[model samples]
Target: MAKILVAFDTRDEGFEKLGSEHEIIRPPKGRDFTLEELQGLLPEAEVLCSVFDRPARAELLEHGTRLRLIANFGVGFNNIDIDYARSHGITVTNTPQAVIIPTAELTLALMLDCARRVSELDRLVRRHPGESTAIGRSGYLGVHLSGKTLGLIGYGRIASAVASRARAFGMKVLYHKRTPLSPEEETRQGISYAPLEELLRLSDFISIHTPYSPETHHFIGAQQFALMKPSTIFINTARGSVVDEDALISALQSHTIAYAGLDVFEDKDIPRLPLCQLENVCMTPHTGTQTADARRAMNEEMLENVARFLAGRSDLDRVV
Candidate 1:
């Protein structure tokens, strides 16, 4: 049996199927492993079950003399150094199938929260109990989205799901991918293709769904924000680094864009000071896939990848 070092604690029940076949090393329950702890454990580990919170850089991977596979716990494996892992003859895998539904749900939730002012209004009501006067239509008015345009940054599975939901809500879906979809596919999907600039200008609600990479880093910045309509409602359930937070904050402060809903932040876990302080912004601490079902599915998918690789099955989710 191989030695598996998990960087973070997860649902213990997910590992029951492994059935003591492999030795599993993990941090104490409710706590994540530190870099120092990871380095110390890697030398004896043949597999590393990594999470997105920590950076699996070359510097740390070098310490894993016995490491062969990195079964990442989440869909976005940007935190791992893919080139370095490949050069070292290590395989990387992620739980893409596990993330689709829950993340899409979170994207919709953020969009609705932004449009209806759910989070802000909830907080206001809680802070001032029995505040019936503010409930009137004249106060705290929010944007309506019955027949507005929705722009999707990436046309991946998550974005496609979001498109379906938006259409159900009477939204006109516009998507921008690196390559445009065929006319037939577009008609079937009930979505229209638009250039990035055109989508930014036309969308009443803009949601990002791209992965994080060199090309995508700061993909949406001041220039992109400048293209948006002042009444636009921005939503980002994608990697935070994809958008320039400073520019986004500036846009919100100046009313360049009406509001924003963010799940991930550029600072990994903690958001910047003024971002949380902004009344028009609603933020979640990267809980898109935090549900119990999502966690179990992710853990199961990752273990399946490990099982396949160990069984010498050539077919695997090999990113590197």
Candidate 2:
């Protein structure tokens, strides 16, 4: 039997449902797999199933002679040093397909919340002593989404899903991406490709869906915020660093932008930090891919990668 080490916190509620046959070693602490200690407990393990924490590093791989796979419980595998893992002959895989709709749905939720100030209104109602006729009129006045231009920063699977929902709501969909959608996809999704600058300038509700890469680091900064309308709303379900945190704060302070709905923070600790002090922003944990169905799917897929590897099959999610 192959030994599998689960290094981070995972309910793996899906694995039990999948009924896969394997010997699993789950860490006691939900998140105790620090680099310094991972190898000591899981010396003979053939796989490292990682959750939100960072995957095995080059130095850490020295303790991984038996480690053949690093199955990430995520879509973004940037946490793993791919090159180093490849050189060490360790395969990496991530659960991808299951989270598409759930993440898109969350993106839509954030976009709508930011546009209409949903979070602020909820806060308002809670602070007031009671719901009253005067309070209803004075508390919250939000914008409408119908007939608004909905901008998407990426045109991948999740972006396409968001465009579909936006279209159903009668919003004009505009996308700024590396490549134009195929003519067939454009017709199917009813979306138009626009220059990044044009999309930034024209969108009433701007949502980012791009991946994190060197080219995309801080893709939206103070200059980008300056291009938006004062009435514009911002939503980010993508990687946190994609937006410049300091620039976003500056823009919000200057009232250059209306509001922001963020799921992931540039610094993941922003929710507990001074950034959460602003009333114009709404944040969720990095939970776009955290729906029940998505979570199970991620867990199942990761385990299957492990199962297949032990069966003498090549690792399918190899980063190298």
Itemize residue pairs with steric clashes in candidate 1. Answer: none
Worst window of 10 by summed lDDT in candidate 1: 129-138
> Deviation in angstroms for 215 in model 2?
1.5
TM-scores of the candidates in the order shown: 0.92, 0.89
Alpha-carbon lDDT of model 1: 0.90
Q: Write the per-residue lDDT of candidate 2 for residues 49-107, one digit (tens) a residue.
A: 87655756667767877887888888788778788788878888877776788999998
lDDT of each: 0.90, 0.81
Candidate of highest lDDT? 1
Clashes of 1: 0
Clash pairs, candidate 2, are none
Candidate 1 C-alpha error for residue 281, in Å: 0.8
